[model samples]
Target: MSLSVVICCYTAARRVQLIRGVQSALEQAGDRDEILVVVDHNDALLADLRDSLPHQITLITNEFQRGLSGARNTGVARSRGDVVVFVDDDAVLATGALDGARAAFEDPTVVAIGGAVRAEWAVGSGPSWFPEEFGWVIGCDYRGLPACGERIRNPIGAAMAARRQALVEIEGFSTELGRVGDLLAGCEETLMGVQLQSRFPGQRIIRHTDFRVDHHVPADRATLRYFTRRCYQEGRSKAVLTRISGRQAALSSERSYTTSVLPSGAWRARRNPRRLLALVIGFGYTTAGYVTGLLLSTRSAAAA
Candidate 1:
């Protein structure tokens, strides 16, 4: 029942905070636990980072740079815990999060459990009129309330844990989808979620309100350009997910005419039509990306 905390570190910018996250996890872990920080590349900070923690923090550096997905896979390979808890280098777990997660995964059917991700700077982040279904910009309850339940989709990568065996069975995260260099896009986690659901239909992918993590959204992500880019990427990823799964059912057509775009589209539209316009542009971009990805795949296959 030991827990393996896997923090995939690309650079040392987040080394300190991630160490704190590791320490927090160690404190909360009732069973035997070890922290495996997978460093994708070697840097001057490596020496200092190595000396900064207890022997429990095992640092595994790659000979060549592997991206986030690769680093995670590396960590998973080197870990010894039955449950592999993954937290982004920039995220810190809330008190008792690991304990709650342990209980959540006790059900044999449950393969994974994701913690509630609350923005550390939620005070002035955005208008409350945002949609909950949108995964690009995730923000849990602002005032620290226990908002727990079954999730319709995948949980944020900020804080989630899975049985090591299940992750191995699924082959871990996807290298094709997540942010590696400057891609600024993501869908690997969502695609994994879809696969998990397909393989284990009765098993509930529970989001434990009791298990929470604080994600510090950089100020750069608060701008309009960033939000729009995120929306575009999300739309693109949606198309990719649908194409891979062959599951398309007029995603937004179910909602009432007024609120079909997003949860807060109607509210924003009442003030300015830009909200609806944004939705249209997002969908168009998504369709284009999806078609382009499919065509490219076909071309590559033909060449092969």
Candidate 2:
């Protein structure tokens, strides 16, 4: 099966992190259908990459729009492969990850695969106040995920691979949904997965936890303010997602996460006083964000 790996970058600030991503791709590279570096409306970054990237790797300027979704869509357009894998510019893949993707796509029913991501803390350890249950804040596959390869609702953008045909059929990632420049908003991945499922019922969007990557979480993200803001932004993003993809099913997992997961995590943290407080604050902030976002969304709908 032919494979195309796409990496998206938006700034020169991430140049060091981007180098690590490039090296990982090089190590995993073979006869790729193509390896594209999609620069998202950043001419300066694009120019710098022109002097930096190896000649074998294809460079793409995202003319589609100015977000991660658009950059990814541009990459998909330039790619000629049965399967397209999107990797984050800040992540490094595990050995044989690409090979595993090629093998997984051999099954025609497997439309997409989300590999696990292990957090690599910039300070070399997780912050005490940063609850592991909220790991999704950094785009890492947080806890409560399935322990093995199985049908998953969505693929985390850090390392998600999908069939070329499925992405085309669904019209690729939504420009309204994902990260644009500095925004932490997501749910574009969720929207794409929902579309894929709608079009090809019973098709598998598998989560293979063993196909892993090291995702760097900067120390700045360890702050309570950052975590809370990210959670708030996620709530807003999900509101938009629910609007675009229907409410009940789009929020099924959110209900589970709120009603079940956080409560269990709070119980587990009972022994640790700080952790207990962290869990409570985390849940409170996130729920508040979701409600506020929902209200704003309702107002927007009424106006429309």
Clashes of 2: 0
- Which lDDT value does model 2 have at 61? 99
1-304: candidate 2 lDDT, tens digit per residue = 8888899999888788888988888888777467899999988999999999999889989979899999999999999988898989999988988887777778878889998888888988887766778888888977777666788888888999999988999999998889888888889999998889899897888997656788888888778888878887887888788878888757867778888888888888888888778778777776677788789988988999
Candidate 2, residue 213: the lDDT equals 84
Candidate 1 to truth, TM: 0.80
Q: Mind giving the per-residue lDDT tens digits that candidate 1 earns over 1-304? A: 7788888777666676778777887778664888887777656656767888777678787533367777888888888898898888778888888787777777787777768787765346643433333334543332212247665446567887878877787877777667674456766666767667766778766667666787766666655566566656655665556566655422322233225435455444565555455545544555566566666666877999
Evaluate all candidate structures by whole-model CA lDDT and list the values in order: 0.66, 0.85
List residue ranges in candidate 2 displaced over 4 A.
none
